[model samples]
Each structure stands twice: as C-alpha cells, then as structure tokens.
Target: MSITLKLAWKSLLNRKTTALLTILTVAISVILLMGVERIRTQAKSSFANTISGTDLIVGGRSGQVNLLLYSVFRIGNATNNIDWKSFEEFSNHRSVDWAIPISLGDSHRGFRVMGTNHSYFEHYQYGQKQHLSLAKGEEFDGLFETVIGSDVAKSLGYDIGTEIIIAHGISDVGFSRHENTPFKVVGILAPTGTPVDKTVHVSLEAIEAIHVGWESGANLGNEPSKEQLLQMDFQPKQITAMLIGLKSKIQTFALQRQINTYKQEPLSAILPGVALHELWGMMSVAETALLIVSVFVVVAGLMGMLSSLLTSLQERRREMAILRAMGARPRHVFTLLVSEATVLTSIGIICGIGGMYAMLAIAAPIITANYGINIALSGITSHEWMLLGFVQLAGVIIGFFPALRAYRQSLSDGMTIRI
Candidate 1:
C-alpha cells in the first residue's frame, strides 16, 4: 500500500496541473450541491421558527395561503379586515389565553406598519419560543409613538426619537402622505428573524389617526385641518388579523370552529403550525427541482474527472512500463492510479466545504437585509457528512475502471515503451 501510494504521489506530481484542475472542478460542484441543500434545509427551519407559541391566526375569510402570507410573512396585503366586534368576541372567549389584534395596510418608507396593543410585546414569541426583546429604548407608550423592528431600524438608520410619517396605503408610490400625523420612533426591538423584524408597530388608534383628514383630495369642505385631526378622537374599528393563544392547546379546534361559525361576518382561524406545513408542502416541489439540478451538476463534474483521467492514461503508458520494470506488480499499478484519483477527489470535497462557509459568511448580511433569511455558518450536519462520504466512494468507484485499464496496458508492455 505504501509503495502504491508513493508511486501515486509521483505520478500525480507529473501531471500536477491536470490533476489540480480536475480537483477544483469536482470541489466546486460539490460545494454547489451541498450549499443548496444546506440553504434549503436551514431556510425551512427558519420559516418554521418564525412564529412560535401562537396557537392560531384569526382573520377575515380569505384563502388559507393569503392568511399565511400576510399574517406571518407580511408579504402581501390582507383582502379585508376583521371587524372589531369579531375581534372582541374572539378575545373574550373562554378558551382564549390572549389575543393580539394586528392591523396592517400602512407603511413607512416601504416598511409595513403594524397596529397592535401592548399585548403584542407581552405575548408574541418567535424562534424557539423566544420573547421579543428591546434593543434600545422602550415600547410604544402613546398613540403616536412607534416601536421599530430590528431590520427596519437597521435599514432606515432610525434611532430613538426619529420622527416618521406613515403612508396612507401599501403602495410605495401614489399613496396619500400622512405628513400631518408623523409618529416618533420611541423603541427598536431586537431581531427575531420573522416578519416582525420588518414592521413598524404602534397602537391601533395611531393607524386611524394618520388617515383622519381630507377626503378624495377635494378637501371635502368637511375635511379636518391638520390641527383638528391631531386633536380628533381616533379608534380603529377593524384589524387585519388576530393571533390567538389559547389557554389550552386542546381547545384550539373548538375555538377555530367557533370563529369559522361566527354569525356576523365570515371569519377563519388557522393553526400556525398546520398552516406553515401547508405552505411548505407547496414549496417542496420547488425545492425538489433545485435538488435535481444540483445532482446533475455533481454528476457532470464526476464525469469530467473520469474523462480527464482516461485521456492522461495513454500519455503515461511509458512511465507506467518503466515503473513495472522496476519490479512493481500490475496490481500496484492499478492501486497507484486509483489512489491518485481518490486523493484528488478528497481534496476537492474539503475545498468545496470551505468555499461554502466562506460564501455564507460574506453573504449573510445581504441575505438577511433583502430576504430576511438568517443562515448560520457552523459545522456540517450529519447528513452532509454522509453525502461527502458517498461522493468520495463514488469518485473511487468511477476511477476504478480506468485504473484497471492502465494496469493491463502496463502489464502487456512489460519493460518496453508502449509508444
């Protein structure tokens, strides 16, 4: 084995450039395949952890997907608002532990505006049931005071006491400005890796206060002036969605039934976990497609390695015959070729893993800022290690046939030059 290894090292050194290039090719392909798998797994985990401890999401009747998108992800606007009457009824239910009413539809420079009560800060949890923490200052204290999420604060460079105006609607453009009732950023919450990190939260009344003004841009002869609007009593009669945490999880189904059967307006209550599962079920197809593409890339890289090694064997025939004349067995010749391939592939796998970590380190901030996806660079998972083992085994197996062919040629040539 040692003699085979020694000859392998010498032979690979003779073709150092080709061997190294093949290694790099295989390494890069392995990196891409593994990186995609890691991102997919971690992304799903991150999504699942976005909302924790909330038993159900109660909102106006809409598609289940829409409810998940707007309520948990803050991705799109809610079609309709749940009446305050319905919110009250749900909150007062015997099975309810706490209800957090979330009113959306306003924005501050592209950041969604969320109107909720203090119960939001007190009851809402995320990422392994962790409570929201204040990064700076305190929670919103008055109607016009606002608490910013971590990403909002970071992106907008907001600090305590920064005054911000809420736009009248969701559109980044063509929205009435709330220049009259700008709110002060009184707090900044720590990162939660959830949609909450992208929201600007305030009391429900604040959302109503900002919209109290001229109608249809005609000033509505009855329109309230800026000062009058400021002094006007304001209360929100509706909210986008309500997150409910029941006193007992067992009562979840019963409460959902009650909400769905409400006599007045149509309403729906969905379990957060179940809804997330459905969302993932929809996403799995895309994930599988990506996985398939990555597998193809890996196979292509392996085939390239095989082709390169086979092409080099002819040129190395004379060198192999010389070694055979020096008392090397045909089996040793085979072992030497196989060992070189194995070593090259192993190096590629290691380099690929290193490359993945380096990329994650550099791209994490941008990814978090743009996609709100947090990817951690840590030791590879057991599954990934297993994958590496399989790749190495495949490299050896695939190289075996070429190695055997080279050995047979060297044996036939004996001590004479094949060329």
Candidate 2:
C-alpha cells in the first residue's frame, strides 16, 4: 500500500498541470452544486421564519397564498385594502390574542415602507417566535416617528435621528412625494432574517398623514413643510393586512372563515405555514431545475477527469512496465491509479466547499440587499454532508474505470512493450 501510494504521488507530480486542471474543474462544479443546495435550503428556512408565532395572516379578499406573498414576503402587491373597521372587529374578537395591523403601498428608495401599530413590536415574532427587539433607540412613540428595519438602517446608513420621507406609491421614482409629511427615525430593529428586515416601519397614522392633503389629481400645491404636517391629525382608516394570533389554536380556522366571509369588506385569512408551503412548492420547481443543471455540470467534470487520465495512460505505460519489472503487481498498479484519482477528486471537493463559504461571505450583503433573502453562514446540514459523501463515492466509481483499463494493460504486457 505504501509503495502504491508513493507511485501515485510521483505520477500525479509528473502530470501536475493536468491533475491540477482536473481538480479545478471538479472543484468549480462542486462549489456550484453545493451553493445551489445551500441557498435553496437556507432560503426556505428564512422564508418560514418570516412570520413565526402568527397563526394567521388576515388581509383583503385575495388568494391565500397571494396575501402571504404580498404581506409577509413582500413578493407582490396587494390587490385591495382591508377596511380599518373590519380589522378592529377582528382585533376585538373574543378569541383574538394579538393583532398587528399593516398598511403598505409606499416605498422609500426601493425599500418597502410598512405602517403598523405599536402592537407589532409587542406581538409580531420571527425566527422561532423571537419577539421583535430594537437594536437602537425606542419603538415609534409618535405618529411621525419611524422604526426602521435592520436592512434599511444598514443599507441607508441612517442613525436613530435621521428623517425620511415616504413616497406616495411603491414606485422607485416618478411618483408624487409626501413632501409635507416626513417621519423621524426613532428606532432601528435588529436583524430578523425576514421581510421585516427590509421594511421601514412607522405608525399606521403616519401612512394616513402622508396622503391626507393631496387628493387624486390635485396639483402639488405649496404644502406645509414636513414639520408642520406632523402637527396635523394622522389617524388611519384602512390598512393592507393584519396578522392575527388566536387564544386557542382551534379558533384559528373559525376566525379565518369569518374573516373570509366578512360582510363589510371581502377579506382573506391564511394559515402562514400552509401558505408558505404552497409558495415553496412553486419555488421548488426552480430549485429542482437548478439541481439538475448542477448534476450535469458535475458529470461533465468527472468525464473530463476520466478523459485526461485515459489520454495520459500511454505516457505512463513505460513507467508502469518499469514498476512491474521491479516486482510491482498489476493489482498494485490499479490501486495506485485509483488512489491518485481519489486524492485529486477529494482535493477538488475540499476546494469547492471552501470556495462556497468564501463566496457566501462576500455575497451575503448583496443577496440581502437585492433579493431580501439572508443567506446565513451556518455549518453544513445533514443533506450537505450527504452530498459530500455522494461526491466521494462518485469519484471512486469514475476512477475505477480508468484503473481497470490500466490494470488489464499492465497484466497483458507482462513487462514487455506491446506497442
């Protein structure tokens, strides 16, 4: 075994460039495969953690999945708004444990602005029912005071006292500005790894205050400054969605049905887990496609390694004959070749894993900023470890073919040149 290993090392050294190139090819493919798997799994976990502890997400009449998408995930726009009266009714229900009203339809520099009541800080939870906590300053105390999400504060470089104006609509630009009403940043929430991290939260009254003076088609009149607008009434009459937690889990279905059949406003209530699962089912198709492509790439890389080994066999035959004359058996030659392949492939796998970690570390901020998805740098999961085992198995299987061919040739040649 030692002799075989020594020979394997020498042979790899002799064709260092070819061996290194093969390793690199396999390494890149492995990195991509592992990265895709990691991102897919982590993304699903992050999505699931977005609205933990909230039994049901109540909104205006729409598809249950759509409500979850628009309200919790910030993936789409709500088709309609739930009347404030209906939200109050739900909040005042006997089975209700907590209610957090949300008013959307505004953005500041591409970050969604969420207008919600102070109860949001108390009741809303994420990531295993972790309560929302302020990282700096206190929660919104006045209607004009804002509590920014972690991503918003970090990306915008805003501190506790920075003031911001909410846009009239969700447009990034070309919309009427709420020039008269600007909110002060009173607090910054800790990172929740959810859509909440990307939101700019303020009092629901702040949402109403921004749109009060400007009527539809009204020209941008010389409006009072933002400070003056703060002195005016800022009570809200409507909201985009509300999150409801029931005193008893059994009451969830009953309340959901009631919200869906409300007389005042057509509303929808969705079980967060069920809606998230449906969303993931749709997302899994893309994940599967990515996995397929990664498998193909890995196969191609293995084939490249095999082709390189086969092409080098001719040059290695003379060396093999010398070893055979030195009392090296054909079995030893076979073991040597297979071991070399295994070592090369294992190196590739290691490099691939290291590369993935480095890439994730570098791209974490960009991913969160652009897609609102947080890719955590947690240790490898069981599935990922299984993948590593599979890669090692594949390496051995692919290497066996070339090793067998080398063994056959060494045996048939009988220490004599056949060519």
Question: TM-scores of the models, in the given order?
Answer: 0.95, 0.94
lDDT of 1 by residue, 1-419 (tens): 58677777777888889988998888888988898988898789888999999999988888787898999899888888899988898899888999999998878888898999999999999888999999999998777899999999998889999998877667655446666577899999998877889999999988776666545332233435556765777777889999999999899888889888888999988888888889999999999999899888888888999999899987778777887878878888888889988988898899999998888888877887888888888789999998888889989987897888976775566556536
Q: lDDT by residue for model 2 over 1-419, one digit each (tens)? A: 57677778888988889999999999999999999998888788878888888988988788988999888887788989988888888899999999999988889888889989879999998888899999999998887789999989988999998988778666756456675566889999988778888899988877776776667624356556667766887567889999988899999888888877888878888999999899899888899999999989988998899888888887778777787778878888888889988988899999999999999999887887777778989898898999888887888888888889878875456556667
For every model shown, the clashing-pair count is: 0, 0
Candidate 2 Cα misplacement greater than 4 A, ranges: 172-175, 217-234, 410-419
Point out where model 1 deviates above 4 Å: 214-227, 414-419
